[model samples]
Structure formats: C-alpha cells, structure tokens
Target: MELDDLVEELRARADSARVSQERLGSLLDAVIAVSSDLELAEVLRRIVVAACELVDATYGALGVLGPSGEELVEFVTHGITEEQRAAIGPLPRGHGLLGMVIASPRAQRVPNIGQHPDSYGFPPNHPPMTSFLGAPVRIRDQVFGNLYLTDKRSAPEFSGDDEAVLSALAAAAGVAIENARLYEHSRTQQLWGEVLGDATQALLEGAAQEVVLADVTDAVCRLARADACFVALRQGSDVVVAAASGEGDPAEAPGEVLREPRIRAAMLGPAHIEPGAEGGTRAMLPLALGESPLGVLVAEWAREEPTDHVPHLELLGRSLAVSLGAASARTDRARSELLEDRDRIARDMHDNVIQRLFATGMSLQSAAPMSTPEVRAKLDRAVDELDAAISDIRHTIFALHRVPGGRPLSAEIATVCGDAAVTLGFSPELRMTGPLADVPEDVAAELLAVVREALSNAARHAAASMVNVVVEVADDVSVVVTDDGRGLPEGVSRSGLGNLARRAEGRGGSFSVEPGDGAGTRVHWRVPLASGDGPGT
Candidate 1:
C-alpha cells in the first residue's frame, strides 16, 4: 500500500474511536438523568432503556429486589411486548441466570450463555439472547436491582468498554432510584398525615360508626398504598367488619377476618405477611389503647413485598393502629356518655316540666265543667298549648341528652361568659388558669356558683357592664369574681353569701366579698390543688 493510503486508514480508525467516546459520554449522561429522576418506575425504565442503548443491545430488563431482598422481580423493562409479558405469566421470580448476578452482585458479561454448562435455556417460545451482560445496581453496599442487556446486533462478545460504562451507569441508577424513593416517601407521608387528620376531624363531627370508619380506612389505603384495609371491632367473642377500603375481592379482607389461632396471635402482635396465595404483602396490627386492645387495622400492599416504600408502609401501619385506638376509645366513651345523659334528661323531664304540664292539664280539665262554652273552649285550648310545650321540651331534652352531661362548672362558666358576650353584645375577655382537665367537682361547683351569682347580680341589680372571674389554685384554689357594678342593693344586705362562705371555710378554703377599686364589688375564694391536708382555720 502507498504511504498516503496507509495514513488515511489510520486517521479513519482514530475518528471511529472518537465517535465511541462521544457515545459513552451520552450513555453516562443518560445514567445521571436516571439517578436524578423523582419516580422509581420512571427511573428504572430509563435505566433499562439507557442500558440497551449504551451497549448497542436489542433489549433490557431491570429487576428490583423485593421486600426481603430474597428474590429479584422484573419491576421495569424496555423493548418487551405487553402480550409477551402476559404470556410469560408475571415478572420472572429471578432464578438461575438471573440469580448469578444477584448472588455475585457485580457486572458479568457472557459471550454465549448457551455454551455455558450452568446455562438454563430460555423457556419455550421465550425471547432468546445470543449475548448477555448483567450489572448489579448498587447504592452504597445495598444492591437496589440488576440491569440486564442482551443480544447485540453484531452477535459479538460485550467489550471491556461496555463493562466499564454499564458499571458506572448502574451506580448512577442507584442514586436516581433512591432519590425518587425519598421524594415519593416524603410526599406520601405528608399525604397520609393529612388523611389521618381529616379522618379524626370527621369522627369528631359526629356520624355513624360506618361513616367515620369508612373515612379512616380510605385515608389509610391512599397513604400506605395498600391493596385494601378493613376496620373491625370485637363484639363479644366475634369480630365484625364495620368498614373496609381496598381493591379486588380482598379475599377474607371483605369479610370478618378469620379468627384462626395463628391470626389471633398475630393480631396481638404486629404481623406482616406476604400478600395472598396470588402474591403480595399484608400487615395486621392491633389497635391498643392503655390495657385494652381496641381492634385492628389490616393493610395489604399489592406486590409480594414493598419495593422502595417499606418505611412509609411501616409508618402508616403504626399510625393506623394509633388512630383506631384513639377513635375507638372516643366512640366507646361517647356511647357511655350518651346513656348517662339520656337517664339524666329522663329524670329531669319526669320530675320537672312533665309533672308540671300534667298538673296544669288536670287543673284545666277540673275547671272545664264549671265554665260556659267559651270558657271551656279557652281552657281546652290552654291544655293543648301546654301539651305542645311539653313536646318541645322533650325534643330539646333529646338533643341535650346526646351531650351526656352539662359542661363542667368551670367549662360552663367559661362558655357562659363567652356566649353571653354575643348575647350581651360585647366580646367577653376570659382567662383560665391551673389544671382544667381534672377539676374537683365540689370546688368547681362552689366557684361557679359564686361567679354565676355575681354575673346575675350584675345583670339584674348592679346593672354592671363588666365581670371578671379569676380562678387561682394553690394549697387552696380560689375564684375572684369582680364586677364594675353599683354597690350592694339597698336593704338586700350583704348576708346573701353566708352559706357560700360556710361552704368555702368547710373545705379549708376562703371566700369573701370586698368593694372593688372605686365602686364595684370583688369576691375572692381559694381551694386546694390537692385536698384533705390543710389546717383547719
């Protein structure tokens, strides 16, 4: 060959080498893009597609390790027909050739898998590969998945350059997969938290168990990405499904949970199961509050195991249990209070308004015969009006009965002050001090009575514009009721509080009334935060 011809051939080879370098750079760029992607499925698909392109291979598949990392599942793939996939019957539960890369957890290149003694031939009618390369996608020490590229167009061995580029791409893929998972988890946790909050609020809004529980289960499903969730309460020895949320038949999820001994034990403790005979993951956790186990919230994730969202699922699992426990306790307490309030209302109606109406009806009846037609008609009409009044009272009582009891004296006083502000056409300033959660009944009663009388006096006699009740608790708790009212009524004598003072002194506390600065009056009292240890004065 001539020197000029030889030089031209050498230059041509150099140009070809530069083109390969440029292609490798593009491949790395694609890999970086995959790592930065915010969705796991998208990242996985991108990785597979990039892999096929980088190695000049015809097809690629990405297999993410399942929940336990015991098995690799074909989670995402490229260059595969949907019909072919369906015919293959679910993503391969990685075994044989697939298991080699997973077990070794590094890049492996095979010139001809068919020639190998360890080769497991493809299933009949399955896609065949003349050349293959598998690289484990590692994020730190954890293997997220394996990327497989197969059947180069030239049917040649995978080059050393292909190994170097794919290995780097797999590392990048890790960053992307983990990044997407982090973003998705944050979004999911926030979404689930809002759901739980709304469910709690919906329960507080007061509704049937069916309605309230339905809201809770729905919220859990969306948050945890569960296939379904069922809410059940233990009724006698049996558990009844009050509400359910999920996809498909939910197997036994749609019905009362099987109370097999294994199930009962599992329910007593948290148990996460592989999903279905069909395949998936399910977890059941007891809703325990204090010593009593309330019930259970059961969740099923459709995959045999959680992929990148195990922590999110676990978070939701614990949250679901807490919500159920709290909601159930509220439900039970409300139920008990309902009965108590009904009895109280019934007694009040019998002893007060109902008896009064009955006596009034009898009086009108007695007067009926002695009167003329017009007079008898008037008396009869009075009886009818009285009967209607009785019905109105009964209705009010029924509504009030649901509340279970009058608000605690302290609560009532606070409400009265605030409610009367609007009615009295002013915004009342109210401040509370000390522990309100567990106030003593008798002390609350006496303090409220003092404040109530002061307010009533201010409205009636004092014609006062403002009232202030300051509750102070120490060794003794006190309510200082002050009013910018006209001084004590003439001839009404300040002796009205003689019994109140006795009650206060009897409890080793003090109650007194004194003139406020300028013209109003101030009544102050004290009682103990703890009782029965005070010295008698």
Candidate 2:
C-alpha cells in the first residue's frame, strides 16, 4: 500500500476511536446525573439525550410501559423541535414500531424503515425517518421502559457500532433508574420517621386532638406531593374529611373514595388512582395496618404523569397507615380518660364539696337566730368555709370538663351540664337531632351537655321566666334554646363565658348568642357529625 493511503487509514481509525470514547463518556455522565437527581422527568430527559448523542442519531425517544404492560404511560423525545413535537400529537399508545419493542422486549435495528412491510408509514406531517434502533429497559424481571433512536447521522445507515452503544446505554439507564428510585424511597422513609417522632412528641406534650390532626395533615402533604392531603374516616357512602391541607373541603369529601364499595374491594389494603377530575389528579392511600383500615390519606395532583414520586408516595401511604392506626388508638384512650376524669370531678363536687357547703350553710342559718356576738362570729366563719368549698367545686368541674383534648362529645357535655343543673337550680332543655337512633355515645354526650350548659346559664343568670329546648334531625341536626329574660347581664365576667361558649367552641360547631327581640336571650350551637359509619367504615 502507498505511504499516503496508509497514514489516511490510520488517522481515519483514530477519529472513529475518538468518537467511540466520547459516546462512552456521555453514557457515564448521563448515569451520574441520574444518580445525583431523583427527579424522574429530569432523569428520563437525560437518558434520551445521552442515547441519541451516543449513537449520533438525529432523534431519540423513551416510552415507559404502564403498570398493566398494555398502555404507554409516557413518551419523551430529545432533539425534536417544538413544532415537530406538536406534529407528533398525543403520544401513540400500543401500536406500530413501539408495540414491537413492548411485545418482544428485545432490541431491533431497521436500516430502511420505509422499505420494511411493518413500517406503518408515518403521517405526512411526521419527520422523515430511515434508520431506527430500540432496546428494552428492564430491571430484573420488571420491564421498566424502552429506549429508542432514529435516523443515524451517517448517510448510509445505522452501523452495528451504533446499535451496540445504544444497547449499552439502555442497560446503564435501567441501573440508574433503579438506583434513583431506591434513593428516593430511602429519603421518603427517613422523612416519615421524622413525622412519627413529631407525633410521639405531641402525644407526650398532651397536645389537643385537633393539633395532632393538623400536624399529620401537614406532614402527609409535604411527603406525598399531593395537591390536597386529607385524613378521612371511612364511611359507608361518604368519607368525612377529618383533616385537610389543600383545596377540597375534607369535611365534605365525596364518599365514593372511601365508600364501602372501594374499601371492601381493596380490603383495607393500599390503593391508588389517577382519576383525573376537575383539573385535579387524585390518589388514595388506605390508612390501614394488618386487617383493618383506620382511615384514608387522599391527595390530588395538579399535573399529569405521576411518575415523579409514585414509589416514594407508596412509602408515604404505608407509613401514614401505620401512623393513623396509632393515632386512632390514642384517640380512643384519650377519650376514655377524659370521660373518667369528668365523672370523677363531678362525683367529687357532688359528694364532698356540695354536701359540706350545704351542711355549713344550714349550721350558719341556724346559728343566726342567736344574734349573739360569739354566735355571729362563728356563723360568719362557717359561711366563709362554705363559699370556699363552692369555689373549689367550680374549679374542679371546669378543669375536668374543659381539658380541651380528645374527648367524646356526648359524655363530656352531659357531665358538665347535668352538674350545672343540680348545683345552679336549672335543668337544661336537652334536644336530640339527626339519626339519634344510631348516634355515637360520645357524640351524643357532648351535644346533650352543650344544651345543659346553655340552659343552666339561661335559668341561673339570664333571669328568664321560661326556657325552651329543641333538638331536630335532618341533613344536619341542630340544638337551639331560647329564654325570655335579660340577655348576658352587664358585668358578667369572662369566667362565665364557658357556660356561654362551651357548646360551640368545644365541639367544632358554631356558637352564637343574639337578643331575642322582645323578651330574652337565644343561644345557638351546632356540631358536624363524626360517626364514620354513616353508610360504611
């Protein structure tokens, strides 16, 4: 061979070798970028760009197979113009060349795509393509997605070298995708660990039930990336929103998500959905542990493609379920303790302080007849002791009933109001509304007690001639009482507001007092229901 031809051949080989090294470097960079960032979209974009550059192709695209392996969840293309992408339109699902990769789960190279009988000609607006290369992305037995490239830069066609590089990149992408997912999962678990710690600390601090619910909702929202985070108690036909972090009214959440139909089908297990509705995307995490469902944590997404955080979100769902079980158990215990405390305080006042005060009052009244200096002094001492006992009783009752933590509505209210009537000379006008037949014991107690307080205040302080009490049932049950007398007497201290405000403020209900036109005072109190068994649990 001539000297000139030999040097040209050596230089040509050198240039090809240099190009090969660059492709390998690009592949390594893509993998490293994926490892550094767990964001799925960014990782996917990098993967496509790297494959295309490695093969020196004009275009590259990646499509992720759906959970069912029947539909294409997403398709991302690199090096395609904005107008070109518009021409591509809504990504084709399972058809044409894309389906071949899915069905075979193997690599394929088409040097002359148009000449092949299976080419399935592209629309007129679609870009011209001559060469095509695609490889499956699989991790272990799970088929993750597909990596594809088209129209090699070489005028002739895609070389075997091009095929080899793309295949290598696909394999590398699979590993990176797996690693990124695992890293995200680990971080998510760590975050949930923090939430568990916070819940524990709040429980120890004796935080109120509402406080606990709020803390949980905030954590769930942050970790899940949901548009709305809600802690809902499962009901038959409706799931009441117990706590929420975003737009929808959890209190009024549709029952469909938590309905018996869904739960029974799901059987207290974790479930999800992208049921796109009202420009919102929703996913439900069943708050269950073992064989029971305590509640559900629902979240909405404002964007399509849940690819970003689905794996991490699943972890959040499981952790939230465990946390919910613990919270539910804590709630039950707190309520039991509250009821026991209320009863103890009520009994103490009735048996010890009330009796002592009455006895002392009697002794003082009897001694008053003597009208002697010594007797008068003794009488005065007895009266002072009696007053102290009454004050002690009042303090004990208020402290026990106004704990402001987790307690059943029915029991707490009954104890406070019933005691007031016995000690304050007025019986509350109790009313029952709604499906009282199946009302929860705790809820009933709270509502009834609210009535008792309003009545006690009206009779004892309002100086009303008559008191009317009514409880009604309907879409919403309400208890309202009216008295004909002076309204809140001037000089009434804030200490007395408990009797005035306890009903509304205590139970998440509205409490209002307005003048009854010509005669007296009217107190209104309302509480939303919490029985999750409205239709199902």
Candidate 3:
C-alpha cells in the first residue's frame, strides 16, 4: 500500500471514467443526428437506426399509430434489407406484445420476446429474435408511436443502461418529430396561401367560373401530389362535376366518387378519407360559405401516400368556397345594375320619345286633309310613316321594361317580329330549332341585333307584304331574313349590310345578301356557337 499501488488504482479509475465519457458522447451524437432531419419520415427512420446502434441491438423499428391510436399505419425499420422486408411480408399491426407495450405507454424489457405470455409468434419468413425493448414516443402529451429493439448484441438481456439510452433517444425523437411536422405544416400552409391567392385573383379579374374551378383543382392536385382532383357542385337534387384536373379520365372520377355516401355526409360534417377503387386514397371535403353548402372537393392519391396535409386541403376547399361566393355576388351586382339601367331607359322612352312621336303623327294627319290631291297623297304617306315610328318607339319601351329571365330566345325573336308586323302591315313567318336556351348571352344579344336590323330595313325599303325569318341554333347559329319585295338597286350603298357582314366575320362566321328565289332580298347571317369572340367582335 505505497505510492506505486495508489498510482495504479488512479490509472484504472481514470480509464473507467474515460470509457463512460465516450459512451455518453456517442449517445449525444446519436441524439443530434436524430434531431437534424426535418422530414418526418426521415426523422423516424434515423431514430430507429440510431436507437439500434446506441443500444447495440441487431434489429429496430418505429411504428406510427393510425388515427385510432391502436393500429400501426406506418412501420419504419433499420437493419433490414428490402429483400428481408419483402420476405417478412406485411408489416406487423399493433397486436400481442406490440399492443401490450403501446397500451402501457412505458418502456418494456423482455429477455426473450418469444417466451412472453402475450407473444403472437412471428409471421412466415420473419427472422428469429430473442430479447426485446420498447419505449413509447410522445409529442407533447400525445403518443405519436413507439420505438422497438430486439436481440441486444452484447448481452442476452437489454441492460438498464441500454433501456435508459433508448428511452432518452425516444424522447428526443418525439421533439424532432414534432419539429418536422411543424415545418411541414408551415410549408403546406404557404402552398395553400399561394393557391388561394391565385384563385382570388382569377375571380376578381372576372375569369369564368369553370376556369377558376379548374385552376383550383389543378393547384390542389399538385399540392397533394394526387392522381386526380375535381370540384363537384350541387345542381338541383343531384351533384354535378363542375371542373376537374389530373391524370385519370375526369369522367371516371365523378361517377365513382359521387356514388359514395361519405361524400354526401361530408357536406354536413367534416371531411372524410377513404380507400379508392384504383388502389389509392380519396379525400372529400365539403366547400361551404358559412351555413350554405357550395360543393365538394375530391382528391385522389396512391394507396400508400401520406395524407397528413389533409387539413390544408380542407383550407383550400374553404378558400374556393369564399371565392365562388364572391364571384356570385359580383355577378348579381352587375345584373342588378343592368336591370336598373334598362328600367331608366324604358321610363325615358315612354315619357319623352313615344309622346313626341305620337304628337308628330297627329300633326301630319291634320295636315293631310287640307292638301291638294297630289300633295294630299304625299302628306298621307308622311302621316303613315310617323304613325309607324310611334309604334316602333312603344315596342322599344316594352322590350326595355321586360324582365330578363329564362325566357326562350325564339319567343323573344317572335315578339320582335310581331312588333315589326305593325310597321310592315303583315306578320313575318318565323321558325326556330335546336338548343336555343343554351346559347351564350353575348351571342344572343348579337343575334337579336341582327334580327332587328333586318326587320327595320325590310319595313323602310321593301314594298312587299310577306316576310320570312328562320333561326336555327345548333353547333352554329344561323338567322335568315327574306322579304318578298323590290330587290337591292344596282347603284345603292347599304351601310347596314356592311355592319352585319363585319359582325358575322368578326365572330368567325359569315353573312350574305342575295336576290331571293324570284324577287326581294335574302339576308343570311351565321355564327359559330363556340367562337370565343363576343358582341364586340
């Protein structure tokens, strides 16, 4: 017991302290590595691998719980090759011993996992293992999943130090998992903002509803990395597919999804996610503006794809609902303004133009009786023309006061021709066919303008009685006006005919004026229904 013995003891103690320090440093390094990654899947994978290496275990895994908190939705593993995983067959659900550890919410250490009373035995082709340790991973107060280690390399049992190290690693993993989720959530929110911004801008800029809906669907599909996305709006008692974008045939998605009860249920409650027929996941979110239901947004993705961003998808649906509501309000405002303007113009015509025309007609009639024979004939013609002008002004007032509703285009054209009959002294025969109700507003306006112009010209210049107006509305709309009267003079200039020709040509259509079968002039105007041009064209 001298200086030599004392120095030897000190050296042994120093060596032991150095070894403990190195082990602690290794554990710290593993913890750091686990916390570095921001991706949730990568973080979970790193945790499993680091936990296995820290505890000197031959196999390790991290099982993510499903929404029910009982089943394993995802299983990330370390120390197993792709072939080994394939051989192991499907991943283990939380059953038997795995369920026991998950339910307990604490660390579990077993010398031999096989000998445990709750063991369910491994599946076919699964590697044999002895000894087991598990720790529940918690993000805040919620248990996110569990970390598992089997077959401790240095000992038959997982020592207390190994259990402590794994528990600490699991705790660190939970924080890392939460951080990764927040990062992902923030990024998803940013993407959703961009999508909503685009939609709002499009609607504000007066983009068509169909175009806005398509843009929203495309943006959501891209964000969800989905195969297809669609917006279905409620029409009457049934839901109709409004707009869709994706890889699959759009026609296929609507029929399959609209048939699901969950989609209908979603309108009243929260969004629902279900397995799709084509080995994918389908998420349906109800789009509403306050208590009013607008439609549903459906998203489809591969079967194994992560749906953690579903909340963001719902946000997109809500944003789209708001945009739709705004667009509808804007349209209503515009229509109201138009109606108000029409009412004002109608009042002016009745109060001023019609009264003045009637007075002028009376003055001409009074002058007709006092003239000589030849002059009397000319004065009588002037009186007749003035009476016709008054009649036309009254008809214009009636048209202006008419409510703009779902009245058929054919009926409107007939009304115009009937008014023209008073001026021309005989009714024009009218015939119409095809889907006139589906005609766009601007096209209808132009068509009506052409009809009025043709009728006015016939009344003013034609010296015959019978007239025929035929309107056909199919994939293209055509209007023919024929009058049995004097044909166009050789040297006369017709500016109205030029305007009508320009109108037809601007809309990628045609207009023609030719002599009728025997006499009179035939005016033909045709325009394609799908031409993008409007009244200006």
**Who wins the TM-score comparison?**
3
> How would the candidate models be sorted by TM-score, starting from the highest?
3, 2, 1
Per-residue CA lDDT of candidate 3, range 1-537, in tens? 699999999999999899778778978999899888898788989999999989899999999998889889899998889999998899999997799888898999999988999998999888899999999999999999999899988888898888888888888888999999999889878888988998888897789777888888888778788888888887656677778888756454443336556666677677778787677888888989888888788888876454676878877888788888898788778778877898899888878887887787678778877889898877766665665565456545555644555357777898889988998998999999898877776677667767876787788777768889999988899999999999666633465566667878888899888889889989999999986565433
- Rank list by lDDT: 3, 1, 2
TM-score of each candidate structure, all chains considered together: 0.58, 0.58, 0.68
- Candidate number that wins on lDDT, 2 or 3: 3
Please state the error at residue 441 of candidate 2 in Å.
17
Model 3 ranges off by over 4 Å: 1-15, 206-212, 225-227, 233-242, 246-281, 288-294, 301-310, 327-408, 411-415, 418-434, 438-450, 461-537
State model 1's lDDT: 0.69
Q: Give RMSD to native, each candidate.
A: 19.0, 10.4, 7.2
Per-residue error at 105 for model 2, in Å? 3.8
**Number of the top candidate by lDDT?**
3
